[model samples]
Target: MRIERLWIPEKPSVGKDIVQALIRTKRAKVLNAKSAATDGYFSLDTGDVVCPLFGHMLTMLPPAAYLTKEQNAGNYFEFLPLIPQPFKFEPKPDVDAKGKAHPPKRFNLIGELSKRAGQIVNACDIDREGQLIFDEMFLYWGLDPAGNRFLRAKITSKAETDLDRSVTALEKNGAEHWVRQRMAANARQVMDWLLGMNGSMAYQQLTGIKTMSVGRVQSPVLAMVVLRDLAIQTFKPQTYFVPVVTLADGTALRWEKRKDAAGTAGFDAAGRLIDKSLASGMVGAIKAGARGTVAVASTKVERESPPLPFSMGRLQATASKQHGLSVEQVTKAAQNLYEKHKAITYVGTDCEYLPSAMHADAGAVVAQLASVFPGKCAKADPGRKSRAFNDEKVDEHFAIIPTGLVPALSDAEYAERAVYETVVVRYLAQFYPAYEYEKTSLVVMYGPDEFRASARRDLVLGWRELEKPESTETEEAPANGPSRPLPKLEVGQQLAATGVSLETGQTKPPSRYDEASLMEDMISAYKFAKTERDRELLQETQGIGTSRTRGPILQNLLKRGFLLSTKKGKRHEITSTPFGKETIGRLPPWLTDVATTAKWELMLSAIALGEAEMQSVIESQIQYVKTVIERARMQVSPRQSAANEKGAGAAKKAA
Candidate 1:
């Protein structure tokens, strides 16, 4: 039987060493090596009577030439030239059937090999996209689909040991789930194409906007940003009075802030603070000599589970909040660590927890990471298992862990090493014990006014040791610092008013969104969705976008002027631009709300799992699109309406 290998030049440059090792293990000899161009098709003959074919390069057509007139006359709907044009894939004559036919132009090796080979083995990277590439080649060859075989091979590092293991696995058996995953991946691509090509073109024609890009993901993401901006714009600030009283111990305490039965902040119909006079009167009475008594004193042993390991989004949020790194910067650094340094698995994942099986390897990964981050890694305990190691919480991939490739040299490298070290340390922390603490709550009442003080004593540092050094930098005295030791007291114990005063403060408006806070809000928005069914749906679907794509989605919104960032030192506050506000105002109300996308994602997930029908989803989406189009047409165009133009200008000024 003959065998063939198809390759792309770009792949070899990045992956040749691993490919060579695979071929060597197969005991295949190189019969010939050929290329169309230096950077084009670089194929190797496996000399086992196999034909070789070029990958992606073979299918690429030369750039089509268009005259100025033709370019101007081209339909506005024809936005993406890369998309298959009408009648482009129609069959063409090639010679006769008995080896008289001309060689296939695209991935010709597939056809050549199929003629002699009894079976075909697909050896591609064990990823969804990789599987798609192999499948495309298989179909292109017109070979018997049933005759094709699938092999899963992974190159963990450049080390021969890792390569050998991969080859051994390939020779034994391949993973079937990967094939199903590939089918899902292909479906996603097809769905995106259909939605983007049709919806985007239709929207663009109606809006008469050049280069209006939209997609299943991108459109919803854009709408989210626009909606957030509108929320900020439409927000009306109101004054709320809080009673602040100085206790006997000179400790100032603020009121516990009342909430409605539904747990909403107590406010009037117009969202103004309710019972303003009652709060002010309480503060005055407390200041006017009222002996304070210990109303309640309760201490509880609270064990805080160690934080889950670092997913890309979690890591990015942490880095943004703690290290002041931008989401883009953190993601780029992580990609380098994963792809170039080979120090970590896939950079983006939703799972912040690891399975018990991964715990055994945590020590080795921590040891490797310790070389770069001695301070943080030194505090990590390897043997213990914390809540972060819950296997039940892990999905798709485990928490980001090092691939055991020790990085060396350079200042930039050290910076990336620090980031990777953070990820590794967090990963290791999952196996460490939970941080145990004693939380004490003391409430002192002076007349009708109640003042509260809380203190926490760390009984066991556990995983918290990794954070101690950083926390130390921000530590301060009593009220601002670590909690003070409280004197023994029983309920109703009389306390002398050592100090009494009133502290007046103005109510602050809601803060603008930051990257980390935005991520939290996005997650919270889905979690707190109304209706049990909607909540359950969101719980199952998680959120509108995966952790892998959320950062990029946010970045795209910012790039598209839907979100604007205001920098204040290391902090970035996200706000909406006038264009963003206009977009939100013009968009259908349901489309602009995140809940809609959340629901759609839930349905899509259901469809993927075969719990929901694809036809139903398609029908719903079609109706949604129709409604959006109708609403958009009825609304005064944002660009054309003088009122909207003025409103946008005003919003910009306000921003």
Candidate 2:
């Protein structure tokens, strides 16, 4: 006899809703139902009923009676009734000469399932969520975990054709790493639930605020933004002067100004220049000279390595600057390309290359990409740098790349496709060779003034040929010769200068943060922070949020009015708002500090890698949370209570 197999579709949220609906509609009917016992079977007698074996069992058992004695003792185990208890397994007994054992043969669900065990295969999506879904189903069915064979399918698109191919591939080999990743992913979810539920409830009760929520990452990130705003608000600008001189030939030269003849801007208590005034006399003396001899003039070759492939954040920032698309818009397009078109790999990866196993099929990607990236595609080079092949970096999935699927997209989709294609082409270029260039700088001096000019002659365009021209200024110059060659000169050589004039300008504060600069700041927050320890840890962990979460957090900050965009022509300037300042000022010192979050991230990373204990990290985090709750309670209590009272009065009057 063949083993009987049972499969359940797992959709947790939807399943819970359905169960609740069923209970509400059939509670009375189920209570009134009768059970009939036959020779070898038990039957539920209902006029109208449709359910699987497990559902029928659930209907038969009283909710309260289903719980164990310990679970029924308190409300803490409210969820216990929902826990699934699957049918048991039993082996077949040998038939007697009379053709029956003492219990007799029975046709039942459990007996059927036991016989069918060998034929079972768990077919789940190859991801963490899918693994969890299958795991839950297996546990509920009382199936032997070790005896089960698992098969995973990758569904990158909603189209039937794509799904068919995924199913076929899954039938060939199971995704084992995806199963392990699912375990880690589920662990993270449980940790978040525990922290968020308990922490939010506790903090809300302490602070008297309704619906106040906290999470493993969100609260800490919010605190970081508030802290940054505070720093900006308290920032004071200092005065500094730069002196510009006009030569006899009308050329202007700016000299590095100092406070005194000893080139000191300001001196310490040990008799060094400590103020700008000391450089004032030197500026005056230089101004009187009216001319100077060219002291030095030299230039050398410089090369810039190609940038790594686009992570989601990099792609968004690039699109925002180049195409005027918002980060949200670009992210949506990228997600579509990954999920709907199946044209790209995962979007949030920081790595630029696929794993070694993927290298054998690199030619397929290049061949499929031949049309869009004509000159960019080439056979994979075996001698490529180790940075492009390390397995340790290829977590979950490799970097975003072409999926070897020729894209058929609409006009709007084509625009997004171009942006994605640019990233892929650049990534492929890394396996090629470095671009070379000759840079020249001409330093000229007339009277006491000196001026410098620079020009670059590209020896080879290399990967830069793929980049689109943004403006006439960036148009490729004729590669034939140097546009502005300087005459050879000795140290004392004098030269005539043109365009001489005195230019007056006030000292400006640091520029407001733009998207790219903000990204860089977030990437290197510790280095920019006031303390060395803060910088070290931040650098170690790489920044506040992961690639997956940074763009969303920034968007939230902007939407909440903490950060505002100032548009000047095509450029955007991000400045902190007045409300942002107030919020920062009201936040507790520890909560708002970026260092706090940075340290937390460092500790969390260490824990994930088994270098630190999870319990120790949790203990430190709990203490931090307690401190935050106390500070927020003291600071927000009066204001929040007054607001709540006003709301209650309004509600009462309305009623």
TM-score of each: 0.74, 0.60
Cα RMSD (Å) between model 2 and the true structure? Answer: 14.0
Q: Which stretches of candidate 2 lie over 4 Å from their true place?
A: 1-216, 219-240, 244-253, 256-280, 287-298, 356-363, 373-392, 440-456, 468-502, 507-529, 533-537, 540-542, 551-583, 607-613, 630-655
Question: Which lDDT tens digits does candidate 1 get at residues 1-655?
Answer: 3444332211433345445555777755443444434323333455333223333322322113222333233432333222343211212224576757564443444455446553344444444445555665555555423333434444333434445565455421134454444454444454455455555544454455545555676665566556555566678655555555555454555554333412234544533344567555665665566667888888878776666667666777776766666777778887777656667776546666676776777687668767767876766767876766677876445667676677664775644756776776666666556778777677777664556666677798887776543343244223413466555569988765554444444444456678766765555446546677777667655466666567877888888887787776666678777766665454445554667666766665565455666656665665665555455445445454554445445655555
Q: How accurate is candidate 1 locally (lDDT)?
A: 0.56
Candidate 1 local Cα displacement, residue 441, angstroms = 1.1
Q: How do the residues 184-250 of candidate 2 rate in per-residue lDDT, one tens digit apiece?
A: 4444444444445544544444444434555565555554545555566666644444444444533
Against the true structure, candidate 1 reaches a TM-score of 0.74
* Clashing residue pair totals per candidate (backbone < 3 A): 4, 21
Against the reference, the lDDT scores of all candidates come to: 0.56, 0.49
lDDT of model number 2: 0.49
